[model samples]
Target chain A: MKLKSLAVICLGLLISACAASNDQAASSGSASGASAGSNSGQLSRDVTTTTSSTFAPGSQEELQASIGDRVFFETDRYDLSPEAQAMAGTWADWMKKHQNVQIEIEGHADERGTREYNLALGARRANTVKDYLTSLGVQANRVSTVSYGTERPDALGSNEEAWAKNRRSVAVVR
Target chain B: MARILKILIPLVLILSAFKPAMSQLRVSVEDGLREPLPIAFAPFVTKNGASPNMGRDLADVAIADLESSRLFRAIDPSAFIQTPAAATIAPRFPDWRQINAQALVVGTVGNEPDGRIRVEFRLWDVLGEVQLVGQAYVTQRENWRRISHLVADTVYKWLTGEKGYFDTRIVYVAESGTADRKVKRLAIMDQDGANHSYLTNGRNLVLTPRFSPSRQEITYMSYAGRRPRVRILNVDTNQDETLGPIDGMTFAPRFSPDGDKLLFSAEQRGNSDVFALDLRSRRRERLTDHPAIDTSPSFSPNQREIVFNSDRGGTPQLYVMSADGGNARRISFGGGRYATPVWSPRGDLIAFTKIEGGQFGIGVMRSDGSNEKMLSQSYFEESPTWAPNGRVIMFFRRTPTDRKGRGGRSRLFIVDVAGGEPREIVTPGDASDPAWSPLSP
Candidate 1:
């Protein structure tokens, strides 16, 4: 049986469960990512990103043109920036005016990071938008989220400028 | 890691050469990696009027496989004193030894009546003046390439007394189009880059194709129907199924050591956590529930513990916890962010992607987190996958993109852990996220 153990693999679940009492030896920290649990539900003043541009009301094009339905972030951060907070406020106001609109928040990241980590980071960004809008009275059911990780970049280049432009979250109206 | 999924095939042994006890040649795997043995090859000659190129092609492929292992050096055929036919009939040992050859390999290919081909090869210990191996394999003409791999693997195992990875395949993402809107499709090929094919069309995007450890299946994340979900694909049957009856976005998927479960990261609301789902029972269990991102989980070969990449440390780093998430301990203390921690098939080492000082590197460390050594670094590099034997790692490296924001030149590369320059595995276009399958028959 001892030799057979080397060839066959079972989930670590069984061992961890049986060794719960022994686990007290290695207590550790949940640390940094856990600190991100606090949601910034605070919505700032309404400041429309585009005042001159005209948009086709009641259309997906309006989300992109009139209100600038996107927010940007610093590298590896999901919290909405001051500018992103202003953009979120405008988005909440737009959602209130157009009650029929349902939005899918698409989280994206630049190519400077790893695949799985970037994916999780992207999800954090998307969820941050969802949380903000819901806190401002947007129905939770009206919002969905998906993360493209570093797979879909908005900018094509590898420079800092392109990377900055690529790391963003876009609210797609449905 | 070199555990092979062997399809039983009947091979005939024609013991017409010297007895085994007379062959005194023996080489350990350590010697195979360090000091390459010099051997002479006379291309296999054709008999019974088989395709003119079949014999020579077989010899070429087998020699190439042996050379790829970095265990044997093929002395130039131009230096051979005897013709291939003469060597196949009866090797002139004195002539081979005069050229400082430690070993000699010769073979023959012949046509079989039932629309098949027969290949026979002989390995001779030139110093011992004795035959080490002589066997005949009968396979369909189209499967001639596989037969060459079999020959290489057999010789490799017989020489070094270890499993051979020559007969295996690799799956990776074939990238095209612009950097922003790349058409990423899943592509697979032989270990040496032959018989290439695409698994998914570019209509939707796909990423991170991982092979099942026990079956001819793969799991990946696909952005189809406007959602990112974990998907399981049977390579042989072309049957794909969504991983769950449960929701949200799923990515960073990997199969358990036994291939009976899947470990992946899921995002619900705004948090990312690692989860394990039993394939047989459809039971889902959360491995790590810390608010910090816990992703890219992998089981040790023995299933006793799991290693993962997590950002619980503020920056991403490698962590090892009991397989059941009993307790977690950080394993990486290096001055960099670490991601994609893949435990070796041998359970002795772990390979990871390290990002530091504006550079990305591929490195390996002992399972206990000691003796970390970076094998290669580039402008951007990640996704280190281990060969079944755990002696080599395959990853993708991307050069900095151009001014137009166009994607850089990304290609797959392999490096020997024992030490050597990395070699590029060229595909039709840019390729990334390479996963190597166990040795297959």
Candidate 2:
């Protein structure tokens, strides 16, 4: 009976891995096609996602792998975007699977406003993500938030693409 | 004393000898001297047998002080023809009028039988063709420079209708070394950056040295042994004493308007809170009890209310509370975060740092956080300090390098609170975290 249960767990992992790989391949293929026409020295600048294949035997790895690295925000706002909502859904699923994991949501803003205002904006962004995860069944106690404001930048270049990348919320496992 | 007087007496003589050409000068003393007051300093006419340069030294020091305030446009000495003996010794007013001089300063320096030096001067309103004011003082020759400052202050106040900040001092962290291993020294200087003297050698990191409202003591944060604590240093005595319990990190300290208490922020465990310690009783009372960071506390001019920056709103924002930590209310509701909310000495506005769109800027608003105006925008700027008159503010700006994640340089700058062109204050090296001193006594 124990051997049968272990086989079932392994199969579940395999199926999820296949699903993630298929999604990755599909996204990368579309990204490549989109890059072809926009080669004006900006084609290579793709928002790449790197995920581990082990899958953590549950949805934890899948959720973190999908939304743990990249941040999304609404247009002309420091607030989280719908993409951020979907990302938080993954985090909630991951928290449900791995009840022991705790996470911090770090919010950031683009470099265009006053320092103090940007700090508050970043905090709002992080809290928005944290709130969404809580609503999706993730325990509020397991989620923390911090606002780096415009102090830390993921993309150092001074361009629209760089700014878009910098305006994000990242999930950091604690 | 005689040796020092020998040097000062000759300068005074030259000033009095040339006083006749400056008598008719008139100056506007009200509505803020928008333009520098044009004043003629006639060479002093020495009554006693003294060196020709006798009175010129005293006059020169006074001239330097007034001009450094950037409020006076002094007539060049070459324009003077003859010196008058006293305010009563009048002559060619046209020469001063030709130079468009609005006021004239004439004085005499003579030796007393007691071996002390006696100096006297009069401020003439040339347009009104009358002596507006006159005064006399006796002092040892070593005190001549201070006497010059006092005279300047009197003339400034008489003309501007505002208390002069010229005789004040500024205490700031003199930064050296590199970004990774920085060395900061506590340095004090005349308001115009003259007579700079290092109060503490660069043995540790020091931040925000604030002068006592009485101008006798300074309280600052120093990590002398890698432990952040506040130390009060008496300038006249050169004695330093650490404040209260030293187990936690203490920073952002400023004296109350009354100078009876010190307000500061202390980080115990992981939470930063504002606290006030009575100067005489040495008792500490926590003013903020939030789990989030609460720092940079400043007292209102009346000392009845306090404004500070806190992250209790899930982000840093300016908040005002009673002196006893009652009735806390958020004052900032706009888009961004605010830090270092320093209340102006006049009790009208609060200056702070605002971060938005990846840029740091210095901004000011009403004490209630309305009418917010950003004064300067840069890659990085923080720490807004006010001039005693509440007309100007000083802060620091850092310019990032061309490439990413590289070292940058920072410097001190000043701007009018009304949003004019920002001017950089020249220092010998990279400087940041400036705190303006109260007007000197």
Candidate 3:
């Protein structure tokens, strides 16, 4: 069983690497075409103008599209359901378009676990996302991870709805 | 000799008068003989050029500071008959005496010539019909809250014959979010949990924040940038500098008694050992060379010896060692795993968390780890911090909830080290990892 799981993780890594290479090829082609039209002296100034819209534009729309569909797991568990996998694909597609933009994936937990253990669990949750995104061909350096360890909450009520909303790893524009 | 005799005669008379009522006095070992003295806090009178609510605001803050200590029951304003206008203006003793009030606190909040608030108050012993203490302070309008706590501290010291804890602060970990994606931030607040401000942005997990002897700096463990290292943070400047980099995880940090050295545990491979780093020289010394886990090191009052927790003897127990890392001795022989041992500021005892039979408890023992007394028991409890006086301990407790984990709530609590009923301190959200600051000078 352990060997099978390891093989699955390796396959996921290969898929993510292939997808990342295809994205790089598309971006580099556009960069070369743009550079051919502008002289070297003017390229640096126009580069910022081109990359700003290339990276973060339409990010909010893409993030909103995945809202309410994703579900978080208990600490240290990374197996994704059909719904979460669908949401992860949407996030992966969003990253494919905004290749130049770096994002931070933050993981959080409720206040039931011990402090250090919760931190490690939050890290594992973030790493799960990072691994899945990497398998979808996103660059690892472009995605940083942080864990709040049950400190910041999106909802204030102590009900299930609040807990569900809080136990999530969010993709934030860095 | 004649002047001394004159003072001795009234002292003798007062002692004689109290002899008949001595048996009626019920003083618990924890709180001593004095009943929570009932004092009346009449709304301070506001004079010309002062803010309309200044008087009421000062009085309200003063009352809160006094009440938070679980001492001094302030009488309702409706119970007062007359208010004092000046120190020389004697209170109507009969009016207060009729309401069973033993002491009366009267004050005025007015504008001073220098554009500051001048608050003057007098504590009158209604039964004796004499003023026990009187003082005035000039401060900016924004500092009225601090002025109120100072006033309360003065009254507390005068009445109890001990210094007050009102003018202090607390550093703790404020928790939020869900069980899977939670965020913990390093937060500091007034002793009453007011004026709360976060020191870290919840980007990392921070724990065990200890105030320096100067109360200006904090040493805590943080996983910022995913590095489990110890860092020294200056509260005033918001500047943090990482201590010397060690190969493995470093945690369970505390300042030396003189605040010149920091003692903490550094986990290398899987073996954790106690080490001290000099703040000035940036030099490091290994205090315990044992193969067992040694953590939670604290300095004795003179900084010559250190007390810490170790699993060297098969179970986690308290151990003491010299500052130079020699002559180590096991101090705790009790049946439990003890962690987070903190030497009291008074240098008489060490406070720690004891785990026995799957239940956690807060307890204290003598310097040699004898006379262990459990002050509180709960399903989950850790981190026992002492108030400066060492009379009370403030720790975190979590209640067991239902299957949905709905009722599990973590809150800070304080209990007398003498083992009395514990009192819950209310906070907005779940709070934990409490570190009580030394009394502010």
Candidate 4:
């Protein structure tokens, strides 16, 4: 329908609308850029964009589907809350059941603090989960960690809900 | 000192005619930027006509440099009673004064026999009826921008007795993509955002580019390694190399005052600490060792001390310690968190990012942490870097993304240390983490 209207618009203004043709080219270019940004940005104002493909048991997706594979933290705080603690317990049990599975915990922070400051904070948050899992009998060698700091975010918003979700550590089975 | 700076800045200014050409009758640019002293710039003429339009282009560059500082108002060429021909021949003091121009800049762009461009400019004190400063620079034709900046620096030095920051480069992060998944590359440009070029590709993330004192290399954090660590990019050789063998997620790198050592933060199992490494001897010393997160260490001008940010007190705050890593002391006592403390090149004040109530502000304080003042506030401003002269501060400010997180574009801004409106330094795209280089050697 968009192409049909664009074609009609171009045909109607064929002679005088040099601007129309240029606009068509420019609009198509921007359309792709916008889609790419939104594809990677996932920066919607509304929450609930998190989804995964068909989950196979014992896979990361299955772990995420069975019990959330990530734990959120408070702003600038590394200590886990009751909810995060519970999430870590289940993640520990899953790791214990699958002793062959090795995981890399990726830590992240919201885009509120200085870039370097958040790098340290994210590392701490990832280690907080790493230490928790080790205490819960997850092998230390089985669990590695990397901090993306504020470089990556799960949710891309400036609001409280988005920031809360952004401050998280995700367990990825490698 | 502030009073002296005020006396130096006013374009309506105050350099009383004490003698002849020795003390040129130049004026100050005034205290606040609201009423910048009116200065007129004549369209520079090509003497040999070899380089067509380069004279006008060079004059535009110098004018833009002075105007961006918010200290001088460039009077329109249409308002000039004296034409370029007349300006190049002789300065008609009365003609410039007629247009209410206290200062008039006239120049000629000429080509040398050696295929070099010679840029000459003379700053006339219209109010005092004398020439304030005149300089001639001969360099490669492509270096016309640096020559123009030098012209501006000459005028600025004579007018304010403070060195100009025009002939400098800003090494920063050129960002693309979006919030959740972004690509950052090592990028650089002149202080005025000219000759922009990316030094690194987006294959790996790069951030926090700090220029070496020699102006030939930059130290920054890059994820191209096994983990995030410091990497050195030699500007002249166009080569890249990891910093050291001693590494565990190293980041937040800054060069020492003499450019012989590097200060950076390395994290081991979530415990981060500041360390300094002498580049020549390969000797490394831990500056801050604690359970808390300590990073962003910058050397003092004299290199005898260091100012860094640490959260040892339960919150991120500025701290000072000796260059030898002893006697750590907290300096920031504010309501919110403090980070990125950079010492002024003049060895007086320190610039930092202050986060309070969800708003980020670029602020400065004395080395001892007194006389604190906020320069500019925004949604997300971080990483304050000082100009070569320490008269201005540059930082990156990010606007909040929309509901779809579409437009959280980050840009670089420069604010006068004397307090003025923050002006955006236009770049190719979303830019951040600007590190202002020293004046051209």
Candidate 5:
């Protein structure tokens, strides 16, 4: 599969080089770019996990699919509520059941605050979840945290509902 | 020889007698005019038949720059009584004075021998019937627009006793798509909205592009790494370098006044702190180590202090500290949440965005956080950047998106810092996060 993808990339590069000399090369260039984009994602996934076909009972995929993988936060607040706390507890149990699975916690924010301020808010929120997991016996070394600030949003609307959904922390299996 | 000396001696005596009186009558606008000063602009004439019709085009650009300031009213050229040829010969003072024109601008454009363009312009005090300023510039033909701006700056400084911002450009985010899936590109254009070009393709989400003090470079936050981080781009060469391989997210990047360092925020383990990177030595220094979110830092023009926003007081408020991040004192004590504090180039005031009762507004306050005054109030507006002269501010105002985050539009707006109606700046598409550049040298 690796060889096939590499071959495809080379072919696309050759075609793009030829297309660059022509006025009608714009469409072909995007086609090659799109192929390269998906290939990179597939390559990264291949490097991370040995088994990619299905989610096992205690696997990270199952933790995300069947169990909760995210918890929402209120605007500008990093402290978890009762509902978010319960969700974090469920995630903690899953992490213990699958000791081999590592998780990265990503913090997010709504579009209200300034860019960097929201990034800090998201970082704080992600750390809150990481702290909760550690308290529940998930090893500190097993969890990593990063903040996306308000750059990525789960909801696009400007109303309260959208904002509430956008402010969240997600546990992604690594 | 005797006959010529007799005539020349009398002419010299008359001119010396009138010089002081003409100088005294030269208009010195001491304050903002209640009404824009009426001025006449005769179409620039081309010598040696350049044949590009650039003469009229260049004059129009200068006229637009003057009129946009809301300080000068360009009179209709058809109303002019002085012919273009006579304007070059002698001052038709009565003709301009009859039309109530306080000032007159006349210029000539021609092709130089070295394939360059030569532009010469003179500003006349119409009422006083004397020339105020005159200069000539030579540059490549493609730089005609810059020549026009230079001419306008000459006129502006002579009349207002203040520098003009026409020669500057703006770096901003040209946004498309909806709130949920936005495509933003770093775009730039002249102050008058000409020569619009995109620096980055919309492959990544970009925000808050800021110009370096002296170079053709910008620092902004981008998500190209799948995590938000600060990046710098050299505008001319299109080279981009990640500011830091920081362990966590970094955002809100701004160049120091000297362009030797950058200030931004970095997050780790749910704590956000302000950090400064020395561009020359490639070393990073943590400025603020508080558990609170400290970001949106701006350095004073003198570079001795910085103003930033922090939520340490349980709400986001403006704060000031030394350049190294010691001695932080809260500067905002208003009802609203203050964020995005930018120190004015003049160093007298700081502009910020305030959110109160779900309404966002732009405002200014003293450097010590006193004399707070709101400039514009609307549904959603933020990111206030000062014009080069510090006399005005430009920011973006976004209308609320629909339930699905559709139908939202963001437009740039400029308002006079001394208080005036906020006017929308026309962009080809939705725009936001405007950063005005220093006046072009």
Candidate 6:
């Protein structure tokens, strides 16, 4: 019985190993991801690339680098800060310039909260950004919102500094 | 030659026909073993061209399972005073008594005519000099581990007077990559961590997998469409569908005792509330209308009531309400915040995860939220699921990563409900969010 179980277990291990390697294959495109390629290659490479030379006057690259395509929020609270409000105003203006392009607003949260709550909090944060943009005259149809909760953190630590950076929402051009 | 063989066959049969008188000693569940019972596990004797080391290997798995319960200490085989000579043979109690073993397990493995393995084992009370129990099981060679679990369960129940949880499985999230960008996939494995397999390809994040009481299905939260939503998957068929275009993010899902309904938290415009949905009719009912986070809803075994975690009182705590969602009452007043409250199958206690003094631990309390006792503590531990018998809990523990959270791994652990050290459950990969399934029919 033990020999039989060992064979089954060995087969299971082999299948899981293959699954892990397949994940590596699928995530290998992330080696050139923005600001996340230094160590364990895991960050999504799904973000669109906008080179400096090919950057339009109001493209994602220019907006992200200058006006900031992201805004931070208080812990467990989705209200925008004064600086965040200013950034949101700039983001609205950029949306106006690129009216033809739609955007997805992703809300995120720190690790201190439960996954479900953080998800709701993230949605609130993303919607807060979207509401500010719509109030500033960007069409509601042009902006969609989703929350990743703490699943995709901008910073990866348990410390206050990392948590602060993680409790924010980013605007991705869709 | 035929006459000579007939004489030799009878001689061999008589030589091996050594069975002790059938006697029984009853052990009661009320007389729980306060200290780990010392037991000797004799290697099974193999015969008829069975794998030479099959008996020893089977014994190893049985010993590991028994020891993991923390109720039985498997005495090292090196100290064994006697060994078995054939299948269906009894152990000499005096030899086991000499080694200070209060209980002993002896077994043998042999190849059958139909290309299968037959395992037979017996449990003996050393001090009382009586046979406690015995059984023989025949199956394909590939099912040895299951045979081992059955053996452990038999031994455990005979000695402890409680149903054992060895023959069960756990579903969890298999995680990979750095902390910032984790790839979480839904995975399932045997309780002892064998036959590990991924249900999802990790294309999307999955969390909080739960098994249905009457179905081979799982309800969990997935970001498959890049949106947080409740999804159900048939583990056997690998088919899945989303539950609701629920106004917003839906998560922390659990199935009702009957498996016909599901309870989960749905957050719309930042207000999270618990809701129930009927599987067949696809009718949705709001269970909690609180403006605060009310998640982790679990149903009692009887399905008469529900226990969930809510932060409506400013801090996360446990609350109980009728299955119909009225007359809600707060039941937790412990020092720390509690979350992920799951009712036990035994219908007496609710298991929960506690956050106190900046550390996370697993604990249990009466169904009415009294007599709370901490079972295990660590840097990060949560998501306690009860074994079918409600005598054990399985959870996941995460190691602290660097200051940047650059590296950390999560693994599953199990502990007896009576409070003992949690032992790690070996898996092929980093794992979390374990849910124990009910005993298979």
Candidate 4, lDDT over the whole model = 0.79
TM-score of the second chain for every model:
0.94, 0.81, 0.88, 0.92, 0.92, 0.91
Q: At residue B172, what lDDT does model 1 achieve?
A: 94
Each model's TM-score?
0.88, 0.64, 0.68, 0.86, 0.84, 0.84
The best candidate by TM-score is 1
User: Considering TM-score, where higher is better, how would the candidates rank from best to worst?
Assistant: 1, 4, 5, 6, 3, 2
Give me the runs in candidate 6 sitting further than 4 Å from their true place: A1-54, A135-137, B1-33, B86-88
TM-score for candidate 5, please give it: 0.84
Better of 2 and 6 by TM-score: 6
For model 6 the local lDDT of residue B18 reads 28
Poorest stretch of ten by lDDT in candidate 4 chain A = A43-52
Residue B383 lDDT in candidate 4? 92
Q: Which ten residues in a row have the lowest lDDT in candidate 4 chain B?
A: B1-10
Per residue, candidate 2 scores C-alpha lDDT tens digits across B1-441 of: 112112222223212222333344323332232667788876555655434676777777678767655567789877665445534377456766777778778877777776666777877666666666677767766556655666676677666566665556667778776433457787776555656678788887677788788647889977676455789988777788889665556777899988999998775533568899999899999999986767788999998899998878877789999999988899988787678899999898999898777778898899988999888988888888888877678888877644353455778887767565577766777777777877654
Q: Per-residue CA lDDT of candidate 1, range B241-297, in tens?
A: 997665788888999888999999888776888889998998989999899999999
lDDT of 3 by residue, A1-174 (tens): 222243244335444322332232223222322432323234323333443532235343223321211346643344554445544555565567657667666666654444433443455456567778788888878877665545555444545555555566656655
Model 2 CA RMSD to the hidden true structure, in angstroms: 11.5
Q: For candidate 6, lDDT tens digit of each residue in B311-352?
A: 788778899999999988999898877888999999999999
Error of 2 at B387 (Å): 3.4
True contacts kept of each: 0.87, 0.09, 0.03, 0.77, 0.68, 0.52
Docking quality of model 3: it rates as incorrect
lDDT of 4 by residue, A1-174 (tens): 222343344444332222322232223222222322323123121112221223344566444433445777777899987656766776676676667888888888998899999999988999999999999888899988888899887666788867876788888877
lDDT of 3 by residue, B117-175 (tens): 77778776777766666677776676677778778877777666666777677888887
lDDT of 2 at A145: 70
Q: Write the per-residue lDDT of candidate 5 for residues A1-174, one digit (tens) a residue.
A: 222243344345444322321211123222222332224244233323422333455554444333335688767899987667766776676677667878888888987776667777888999999999999889999998888777678667787877877788887777
Ranking by lDDT: 1, 4, 5, 6, 3, 2
